[model samples]
Target: MSELIELFKDPYERRARLVPALLVALPLLVPLVCVYGPRNPILTAVLGLLGGCGALYALASVARGRGKKLEEALVKEWGGMPTTIALRHRDSTALDSVSKRRYHEAFSSKLGIGMPTAEEEAADPARADDVYIGATKRLRELTRGGRNLLLKENIAYGFHRNMLAMKPLGVVACVLGLAYGLIIAKALQLAPLTFAPGKIAAPGLAAALTLLISLAFFVAWVFYFDKDSVRRVGFVYAERLFECLPSLQPTMPRKRTTKSTASSDGPD
Candidate 1:
């Protein structure tokens, strides 16, 4: 399972999609060929083509799952917080001069909003350059360990976004599978079968069954994995976030230390 997951990490790789496509396509194709290919090569070819397409879609699903996992991991590793500070003066005309002065001061002292002066123009330019110097303590309270908390939040957000994308795709795949099954069933009824004497009644039935089963599996997978995975990722991310911000930590109730008065009884 670990190896399989590792293989999925590079979603851009064609193998990820190809493997799943084969898995689904082979099973469906086998049943269809056995049932329908004795006399009509054309029908068999058509079924194979359809099965192949379905297989490709199955592979895409696997790739999507892998991509989500990889995205989350990357976000977590980065510690997801703003590493640089952008500062802008109140007047637009004074912005460039103010920015240059601040940049020079920060570079000379290695203090205040830590961002490379050269890269400032190239980076997220839309980001406001307002520096709330007094908010350092509060910012620390909001995001502890600076980057670490931000990284977790970013990862959590990624998981949530991926889950949202998967939910819709799962629904669409299931619906398409149903429609495909109906179309195949109608096609089978129109075509005559030429199986060996006393053999199974229909060949196309197997393909339909395979598709339906795969569809069902995918739907179940989405429901079982997507939301729960996102929730788990979010929970861990939240814990990490809180750990960074000391103020977010829960205050334990203080235990009262009662001093007992010992009455000394003389000659007791």
Candidate 2:
């Protein structure tokens, strides 16, 4: 698990993948922690074994996959990927005409290829796509250095995107925990971690309270998440990414390739 946990050193991995995994897993973890006091040797051993078994690694991977799938669907609903849409001559949702024109000028000058005209987009869309795709690639490379203006936006985008992706599962886990909490509190009349002055705390009430606490995840999903939220964050990231065009130093232009080299890359 240490090996897998180390992956979180990457901002995208932590904000976009691992944190969502942990939120979905929170319901189960909360009760366990409450039932066994935070200092319990038994709980610590269980976690160590679980961590060694790569459970956390698997969870993070699953969350990443789901988040990406959600992103794909949202792209369709929103008409295009944020960066791709912003660079298009016809799309005005992500950038104003003045800003888009400046973006076109910057990339065209830097890359030695014009942003495809609206007529070109209408006539041979793939050619236009190739131009936009190439510019996006360059933007990503350029954004990696300097102050990393784009990196911050990318992390913010990933955080919202992944959190939105795992929302249903997170909500379901919270619902189950809430039900269990009610059961323990009402039927069992147990106080999992109830403290009374110097008295030893019972584990039931605190455990139930932890379950209730998990519902905050559900409420947040309901109140804070939406497909538009992902799109908005993505566009912000895209703008910052493209904003790096001055970072591109001009060189002799290479011949165009026959193949459509454009491929989908995202903030994994």
Candidate 3:
């Protein structure tokens, strides 16, 4: 049961759970409260309890989708790689360790790149350009020929590239979400759709409407923006795979400068 709960912990899953309940309740609640409001408190509470079930259903569906997306991404990245890949197994251990030092140590050792010191390990994930640049440079120095392949294929390097792009995008996403939420809140205050007549009391109704509208816009924004962002991040990841590893350096095509030919008559 605990494991099952942990499975749906992702943000996508949580939002999925919340959105559906709001959608269902948003329509039903206004009617429900109007019909059997302050007069029948017990019945209203019971119905509210039952309505919460929709949230659970939403959570399961969203989590399944997230899991599927992750699996598809992994399948695409893994391609035809063999089952005995050391990095595959090493990743599990690196994730389980609590300490940043331990995680980086395990990851670097697995990739045959020397581990960074404690201070270096403590660098912020959002801005690890200096750390990765230095570590990647050292990784190149230590490699002879094919050893660089290890760094090229390291899952951490891939995630780092993906998340590096995601960091700023995430901030922008949050700002957009907050703005959407605020707009909804303001709209609710201006509109009078409350249970009571002149008093305008229905907190529940206001919350539901705001959530429904704000979430819809947020989902639309993510669909439009994040799809392209994912592609660009993947490109950066592939670029990093080539740049970080010296073994693949020679394979990269060098740009040639075009030379201009002057007229012999003009020179004379």
Query: Cα RMSD to native, each candidate?
Result: 19.9, 4.9, 18.6
Q: Between which residue pairs do clashes occur in model 1? A: 21-55, 35-203, 79-151, 80-150, 80-151, 86-129, 87-129, 88-129, 144-244
Q: Write the per-residue lDDT of candidate 2 for residues 20-100, one digit (tens) a residue.
A: 889887886777676664769787798978877887788888887887788778867876678878888778778999998
Clashing residue pairs in candidate 3, if any?
none
| TM-score of structure candidate 1 | 0.29
TM-score of each: 0.29, 0.83, 0.26
lDDT of each: 0.41, 0.72, 0.37
True lDDT of residue 243, candidate 2: 74
Kindly give the stretch of ten consecutive residues in candidate 2 with the minimal lDDT sum. 194-203
**What are the per-model numbers of colliding residue pairs?**
9, 9, 0
Report how far residue 162 has shifted in candidate 3, in Å: 19
List the candidates ranked by TM-score, beginning with the highest.
2, 1, 3
Winner by TM-score: 2
Residue 264 alpha-carbon offset, candidate 2, angstroms: 4.9
Cα lDDT tens digits, model 1, 1-268, are 4434443563323332334334334434444565567778999778657545554445556645654554455435532211112223232331355544543343223222332244553463333222222222223344534464455454444434344444444455555554444445453232464224222235266545755565675665466545446444544443343234333333332221212221110000
